[model samples]
Target: MSLIDNINKAFDHRIRLGIMSILMVNDYADFNMLKELLGATDGNLASHTKALEKEDYIKVEKQFIGRKPNTRYSTTPLGKKEFQKHIDALEKLIGK
Candidate 1:
């Protein structure tokens, strides 16, 4: 298979890539944290997250932190495997 074929289209966008990168290392990250880390606006982050969630690449959790609402994101098992595959593909491409 081609290296490009192993790259996940779901994580093609910078914002989505950022989200996955963070989730890979973090147990979970809240919306505000991800926004700050990625330097993405609310709408932009939300859209990208929704896209990942739709692909089952990331799981979302909603809860109440006192009176405020909290949305947390974490990578699914499939997400981690796919992301690792994508990284491996990139590494192979670079090595070539």
Candidate 2:
């Protein structure tokens, strides 16, 4: 298959890619952490995160910390595999 075909459309955007990349290395990251790390606004991060959740690429956990709501995100096994494949495809395309 072509490299472009291998690239996951779900991770095409920089913010979404950043989210996945962070979740790949981190056990879980809260909404604020992701927003800060990606430098994204609340709406932007929430929309992208929802997309990933809809794809089943990530799992979301919501809890209360001191009466405050906290939302955390982590990558699923399928997401990890798909992300690795996308990375590999990019490397191959670059002849790396």
Candidate 3:
């Protein structure tokens, strides 16, 4: 298969790309942190996150902190592998 064919369509959106990039570096990030970093609205972030979740690219954790609900996101092992593949494909496409 060609390198371009290896690209993950799930990351076609810049928002989803940003989400994976952040998760790659951080062990885990909460909803508020992602929203603030991406400068996206609650609905925007929620939808994007849900998409990633449905693809099994990210794991979501829910809990309560001092009576407040908290949602954290982290990349799964499979996610890391697939994301790295996507990055590699992009690099190859650019002849890097």
Task: Give RMSD to native, each candidate.
Answer: 1.1, 0.9, 0.8
What's the residue-level lDDT of 74 in candidate 2? 94
Candidate 3: worst-modelled 10 consecutive residues by lDDT:
1-10
Local distance difference test, each candidate:
0.93, 0.94, 0.95
lDDT per residue as tens, model 2, 65-85: 999999999999999999999
Query: Which runs of model 1 end up more than 4 angstroms from their true locations?
Result: none
Q: lDDT (0-100) at residue 47 of candidate 3?
A: 99
The estimated TM-scores of all candidates read 0.96, 0.96, 0.96
Q: After superposing candidate 2, which stretches have Cα over 4 Å from the reference?
A: none
Please provide the root mean square deviation of candidate 1 (C-alpha atoms, Å): 1.1
- The lDDT-based order of candidates, best leading, equals 3, 2, 1
List, residue by residue over 1-96, the lDDT tens digit for candidate 1: 687899889878899889999999999999999999999999999999999999898999999999899999999999999999988887898985
Model 3 misplacement above 4 A: none
> What number of clashing residue pairs does each candidate have, in the order they appear?
0, 0, 0
Q: Taking the tens digit of each residue's C-alpha lDDT, what string does model 3 give over 1-96?
A: 687798999998988999999999999999999999999999999999999999999999999999999999999999999999999999998889
lDDT of 1: 0.93
